[model samples]
Target: MTACGLPRSGPTRGQIYSGSVEKGGSTHVVNVDDRVNRAANYSPAYGFGSDFQSAGQVGADEVRPGDVLGLSIWENVDDGLLTSMGASSTQLQQLQVDSQGYIFVPYAGKIMAAGNSPDELRRLITEKLSTQTPDPQVMVTRVAGDGATVSVLGKVHAQGVYPIERPTRKLSSMLSRAGGVSIEPEIAVITVKRGGNSGKVWLRDLYSNSRNDIALRPGDIILVEEDQRSFTALGALGGQTKVPLGNEQVNAIEAVAMVGGLQTSLADPKGVFVMREEPQSVARAVLGRNDIYGTQRMAYVLDLTKPDGMFLARDFVIRDSDTVYVTEAPMVQWTKTLNVILAPVNQIRTTEQGF
Candidate 1:
């Protein structure tokens, strides 16, 4: 029977949990070092090096729908066969790129213009006209830009949609163009959404490491958000206020110090536990490792009583949504027992005095 209520007696739930765990119905217990090593090996799906989208993969000034271009074609003689074909006449006139990403040119019919830059279009047009006329000159000019735009919103000093006027301008440059993040930049979390998928990058990390400064694509939504990552502290510890994970990573020892260490007189220092559900990345990384707990949830315990336990705690890192629980000391439980037994005696004495 389990520790909860059951007819047959077997391994209690407590024994199963803290002692020999059942295969199907047990939470796995892992040492602090094993847990830390697994976490260290885990790489995030969306963060600094996420291969979501690359910048400058295409030209910034590349042609797109809703753009106007000036196309000109000429033969050796000023008013020759090219002039009669409507090529010379269309040079002075601007042609709008259609919604279907194409433009009509004399003799050439419809040309795919949305993916090619002005210079690229010019060279292509010249090659097409070479068969009809000798050394035909071609000119392509972009009159307007209606395709390259990005939106910057949330927690920024100024939130608005800005156009990426140049190919070299990227994600970081766009944030600067929007007047950058709010007064508290350190705690800002920037989210980039592109093509239905999104990823987050800490502003502090972006500022410190250039590698995190990825390129921006047109129609990309850049949102500056507050750092909402946090952890909870419970039992024999300070108030259960939610502690923010902040912009930078924090180790477990630092987390304990920040929340005020365990209640010295009442907490079992040796029974400190960090309870967490395994993240998919971490689970995948440690799945085949025999030394690691393969369960979905894990309770990483630290015995502060041992000198080396403090060292392990120092190296252990606290993750978001985790709970740092410090169990009560045995003496504290004994005190609670005495208080319950003394309550009746105190009440009886008070009633007698009242008579």
Candidate 2:
């Protein structure tokens, strides 16, 4: 009954090994060893390069178009050009900078406000109004507006547009202004998009490495997201599902333990396999060949019964999208067959004794 293909979980060791060379099969079955463990230890790099780290904090309060400014002008004479109704002072509130970076005043005509500081614009306005009024006093101040602001979104407590203030000019500070990330710091990723350039770094890296805390720019968009790395667990195991990587790095032993270690009653200790696609460089190093191109399919076998198997599994890394499978023991099927054949016999014997 067992030879007639009795029910079992996943393929057996023989099937997996033989399938590697069979027609239409591309998988290469290899045993987990120290050499294979070193070759397959591949991890994708994540960080903000020099392009993002080189920028220093810039002047956050620099005026720009779309900014709102308030101008207060005072003259010694009660009937001065800017004064009104015999008053010696005049207030112009809600003075918005036009698209061309210019703002108009009553006697000052049009003054370029975008590229100048508040003090610079104030001096320029005072000089212009002096021609019509005696020693005109002018004050310019920046108000809340859309200029020099950044948009923060994704996995944060607050998602909105924030102005680039003096204290919130750096990436980390801006994230704090948005109430920080809601996800786990270990798995959270911060992405900054400026113009046509974009960069990403782990939330922990932002503080661990000072260079990652780059300066924030106007019109920049920031997004915080959780890590998406995960592996699939299949066959004779406590839980067969896609398991999210809980840590930054995970090994084969840890991966199996996460899914509730192999089912001792029905699992074959020698048939454990970790299946994944290996890059050309890694495949060449593992197989000692130069014919490899693109990615190649690989099924690494782990025999817990061997003396060095446990160590090999401990050193072997489980990468994203990899599959960990454990086949059922050979005797499990025979036991099921016997149970199916003798169930009726046992029932009939019980009925005879009752009669």
Candidate 3:
């Protein structure tokens, strides 16, 4: 009985297939081919979506509540309303915008500064003070504050609130102002949250895909995260462990090679298998059926012994949380059986020699 069957690294290809369609099991074991490869090819969607991408850039000159402003009023005559004894101009510095978005000018009364640009506010202030003072020249300068700022956190060199300025009016420029990402760009993921909406994209895509570099907005929250896409490699391989996908796309061939390739002396070239939970849509496409309504258990078989086996493996895409298993060669089980039977016989011979 021991010689008939022995312990192996994993189940044989035949055993796996036999149990696939069992009464209690719903696993679909399908041989991978060109058609299946095409149906199963997957690329994760990573973008900021249409609304975020189409948003215009933030107005850097626009003022908001909680900002500080500087105003200077100049009069043609030295003894004007805002001027000192001999000075033709007077300065009002550090005028903070109230919560209601109003700023008080000495002679100009309360003015709304939140929605207006500095130039517009300057013109408005000059017009208001013209009645009291003759041809008053006004200058409005905006100072950075918390009203129009964004918080950047996670995996960035600097985690803090950044103000929207001319140089940092867009998402990419703001990230740069924060000292860029500390993690690898290829695996870094950037997420932006504004109000009730949020979007995510790969860091590399910001430059490669122009649409991903969206404009920044006030009160936006930006986060940089490490990519979590990875798969588990087990059975007749050099090592059994969870491997991170370092690139945007990883195929079966690359995944196998990632874990130090298969154990040359023990791996069965015909029993390489990729196991995953397939979504209903992908399942229907792969099986050429429409009855599957939910996520299904799927086991894709790859026969490396065939002429096109390597090509099929190369074309087969590996998704996150997938399991890549390679069974041991058939001779390995026979070798284990022979060792079990020969152990007792060798022990008996040793006892006879001792007597």
Candidate 4:
């Protein structure tokens, strides 16, 4: 009888399908102990609140074309040669840096002001006017300018190119200036591109971490992407769905719950598994094997029947692009046989007892 049947509560005999095993690649069997030890320690490049910092920043605010300057020149020494009737302060010159990068001045001809800061331009202008008047005072203010600009794209309210005229514009400030993120905080990934380098980070982290919210540099490209980090739940569950892990820094237990846990009666609790594709380096470190599984692609399993499995699930952090699979119990044969053998016997025994 024992050889002919197996209990419904226990996991049925497992088989490795031909398609499941490849000649060179095979899934390493993972159990509760492995999940608690190895899977719990698993970390990916973009997982576990990963910090991807900018390679470099735009050092300082630079003067560029299309910048408008408010120039106020003071010829304090009104020698009457330059001053026309008590003229001490020259009229404000709203000069816009032209395509040739030159701004015209009354006594100082066309002066190159594109590369120099307001202070530097002021000194340059004052020096040029020194021959004409003594102790010349010059003030250059960037009243209006697109000297520094950042390209903001993707899912944000005000998505466009914004000017960064002020010094030290932080990432959070820029995002706010661009009308904040479009959707929920959990579902957004902020990608920053600076010069030849680029990296991505969770918007949640950008909002929380001061280090990650670095200053925006001139020519920095910021993009707010929809959170793509998610785990797909398959097999005997309430529904087969992909649950988005908004900056997913959650554990296995939470992930399972979000995916609707299991289809209580249909799912075999002991057959719960997390399928991960680990990188070559991670796989090699986790498993002693240097095989293709070293590519951070590996399978991790958990048996809820175990007394400590539930506790271990809490520590097991699920990463991006992982698959949570729940295998169903093999109940059809057991149900049929139980009815066929026990039904008639129970009926006869009840009659014999005169119940």
Candidate 5:
């Protein structure tokens, strides 16, 4: 049996292989006829059989223009009366909603049609027609522009404007329409800004059991940020390196691991050092320029090699462009000097190869 609890079948002989039964019944050899019957009766619940319904309702009141309206007229004109009265039928061309949000009708001068439903516009036209003809019959329909468009930019697939047809369109709907996030599981970051206030929404949070509510308006902008995960593994490390940031938050331990762990082969792991760039304002007085220093200042730096440094690392959030550098041991300076001396030879060899 496979993981889904379906019996496995082989190509050579279409029969169920004999296996021990948990109920202690004697195993019977399955015949090809029984196999065909079982195969024919098999039904899967989670595959193509599952139908998808739209997440929200769409109504005509949600219609806007550049919208096309199809208008039809029905009148109680007697056939003989029409023949005697010389009644006529007229067909209009592609009627568009004008800039002022009004549609021009044959008899009705101008009717505001942009935000009104077809039934509502029909009633309005009926009222206008009542002035000239008693009990005039008319019909109005919305043929286009049921869909409203919004734009998504700053790091998303199909990062442009898209049209949404439903009024209950959510933020996730727009993201899906825009081809989801530009990056994958570990590097994706989505930021939703609404009413001048910003909030972060992770892809995992979106798909979690605890759903996050992100409503969308017509002009709302969603930004999917690129992976900014970076660490400068320096001093006392096995290999001084820079690690690329992935989607999830990277801590001091993970950052250190990227540089091949603490150089236990040379330096003391307990004496590791992390050098973070403190905000310029915190060291403003250190710059010895009083005229440039201001009170509205922000600064941050956390050392993670000390015993209590893990707590600081947990509390300290890395900023977008912040750099994290680890210090190497003093004994490593000899290796650095050797590399510095060989740098000229390496460059000369590279130049010779290019030539």
Candidate 6:
């Protein structure tokens, strides 16, 4: 017997043989066939995946002003040898290298600091200081300064400029410092703009296993996107629900589960429907053989009758601003009606009898 106490039956033959009255159990066989047909046609169409790659790449060489300049200098001194060094300290005092990539020092005057390591800066400074003090000491330090400010905008707790001090800064670390992404995962798209350029960085790539490196530069803007679309889910399963599709996408079965899954007494379990708007732009793109953003304007119908359907649930990712709906069993309404009709009559009889 099945869990619901229905008899477990083996697979039957074809329609004519199984449903014919001469073969016996014609109504049962016919119903089974109808159910299969419904399940086959009920799968939803829309899903999710990588949509675009125009976002700018995060490379290591993007440096800005107010960035610390660490320096060390060594020179031949009359009293043995003297070495002096200074690490960039304050946002204001951080060495400001000019457009020509030269930093001005007290004694060295103007020396190139860009594209040079601490040891290199020390050597350069030593060369300049040596001209005055016979054997001058040298030091280099990239101090903490205003040059390393990174801007984080969009769906973060505190969207503004963040200072970069370490050798490497990660996307996740930056987001955490900026108060993290919003609670709504789907509506958020983190855009990292390099050098004030309009291009963005893909959040997925930063989170994924491949090439998870985002070297930040000064003036990079991270924009968090808000939820842009709205969708509704209703039907046989649990209660109807409405959800907004921000930057992320959702799928059919997942949508059903989100609204509390099928109400055992009211849900059919096998019937589900996803209704969505049909936009002309999407159709035009599809017809013109253009790559349309897959997450936009699509719906799906799913049947969760069989065990294997569970696997499909994962592959069918949903989009931001999509809807899911489940319909109730046909007999549920009749059962409710019968209960309502009997309630008044039972109440009247009890009142008259004072029971």
Q: Top lDDT: which candidate number? A: 3
**What is the C-alpha local distance difference test score of each model?**
0.71, 0.87, 0.89, 0.72, 0.51, 0.52
Candidate achieving the largest TM-score: 3
Q: Give the alpha carbon lDDT tens digit for every residue of 54-133 in model 2.
A: 87665876788899999888898877886777787888999999889999997678889987889989989988888887
Writing each residue's lDDT as its tens digit, candidate 1 over 25-83 gives 45655556655655643323237435654444436778988778876666776566547
lDDT of 5 by residue, 260-354 (tens): 76656555443333333333343233233444433322212233446765654443333333344433334444555666678899999999999
Cα RMSD (angstroms) for every candidate in the order listed: 5.8, 3.8, 3.6, 7.0, 24.2, 12.9
| Model 3 misplacement above 4 A | 1-8, 18-22, 70-112, 125-138
- Give one digit per residue, the lDDT tens place, for model 6 in 1-355: 1123322121112322354434564221112223333332222222112322323333333333444664544445433223333432212145666656777776668876766666666777777767776755555655654555688887788987777645336666788888888755534556666643443434553566333345555666777776345567655545665766444445556666777877787665555544444354543332343454343333333456766555555445554344455555556655666666788999999999995
lDDT of 5: 0.51
Residue-by-residue lDDT tens digits, candidate 4, 90-151: 65656888977888887888999887888888889888889877888877888777757889
CA lDDT for candidate 4: 0.72
Would you list the rank order by lDDT, best first?
3, 2, 4, 1, 6, 5
Candidate 4 local lDDT, residue 183? 87
The sequence of per-residue lDDT tens digits that candidate 3 reaches over residues 1-355 is 8955665667877778887855355799989999999998886677887889788987888889999999988998868987889898988999999999999998789999998999999999999998998888999887557789999999999999999989998889999999999998989999999999999988888888888889998899999999888999989998899999865688999999998998999999999999999899999999999888899999999999899999999999899899999988888887888899999999999999999
Estimate candidate 2's RMSD in Å: 3.8
Residue 125 displacement in candidate 5 (angstroms) = 1.5
> Who is ahead in TM-score, 2 or 3?
3
Ranking by TM-score: 3, 2, 1, 4, 5, 6
Clashes of each: 1, 0, 0, 10, 8, 56
**What TM-score does candidate 4 reach?**
0.69
- Candidate 1 deviant stretches above 4 angstroms: 1-20, 33-46, 50-58, 70-94, 106-108, 119-141, 279-295, 350-355
The list of candidate 4 runs beyond 4 A from truth reads: 1-13, 17-25, 32-36, 43-62, 65-115, 128-144, 291-296, 333-355
